[model samples]
Target: GTLLTSLTEELPINLKQLDNVEKTKTALTPVFTQFQQVLEQVIAEGKFTALPLTITVEGIENYLEYRKIDFALGKQTFFSDWLPKAFIQNTAQFETVTNLSSSEVAQRIENLGSGEIKLLSVRVDSRNIVMRYSR
Candidate 1:
């Protein structure tokens, strides 16, 4: 609860009130790609089981769904449009690569180290975007 509260409070005013209709999935592609790239690096070095492949983006949270993947290679991962939209939405995650900017995402990716977190799918419901992850 505390974390969620902090996340809400820290949300950018511009995006907090912004309507999802005006947002474009293309706008989020770069941020998601950056995250994917990070995981891919881990997989290439044998740090993670495989590179995260599957990804989905939505406008609402309720539409988000999770699936079990028995893939021959790669991990699973997910991300939302909020914090990323507010910070790295149009920026480069590898550029800063620290907490100086997007602390939440930076910390999450940093913790993964050389491991790939597969994002099974993403559901963008009316409230928030939910990302699915798997080993």
Candidate 2:
């Protein structure tokens, strides 16, 4: 496996947005493992030389500032219940803007929570670039 200098990808939503917060949070066993697998896969195969790869968020927190809500990549050997809390805490003021389709917005929300939201299309991100999911 080669040492990866950089990797780009979307950050998953928080786990608190689930309808049944406790149950959903408790049921995150598989998701955490999947996340770990993704990381391992990258480490095992990727060899990015870019100092900082650009990762665009496709959800409410498109600017990547909301990542703080997510568990630190290297922390939490068992990341079973941080996703929802992170989402609720971060994208609290999500508003749809131009350049993003309604379907895209809906997809993002869908990725975040198990419920539904009207409009379903709120894309934010103008000239300023926001790097998301950095370790």
Best by lDDT: 2
Tens digits of per-residue lDDT for model 2 on 1-135?
Answer: 123234344334354556776666556656676767767765443322212211123244443444332322213222111222224422332221223333433344334432222222334333212222322
- Judged by lDDT against the true structure, how good is candidate 1? 0.31
TM-score of each: 0.24, 0.21
Residue ranges of candidate 2 with Cα displaced over 4 Å: 1-19, 48-135
Compose the digit string of candidate 1's lDDT tens values, residues 1-135: 001111112222256445664454444556667667766765554434321222222222221211121121113132311122221232111111111223333334335533433433234322232344443
Scored against the true structure, residue 86 in model 2 reaches a CA lDDT of 25
The local lDDT score (0 to 100) that residue 67 gets in candidate 2 is 39
The alpha-carbon deviation from the true structure for residue 23 of candidate 2, after best TM-score superposition, in angstroms, is 0.6
What's the lDDT for residue 17 in model 2? 51
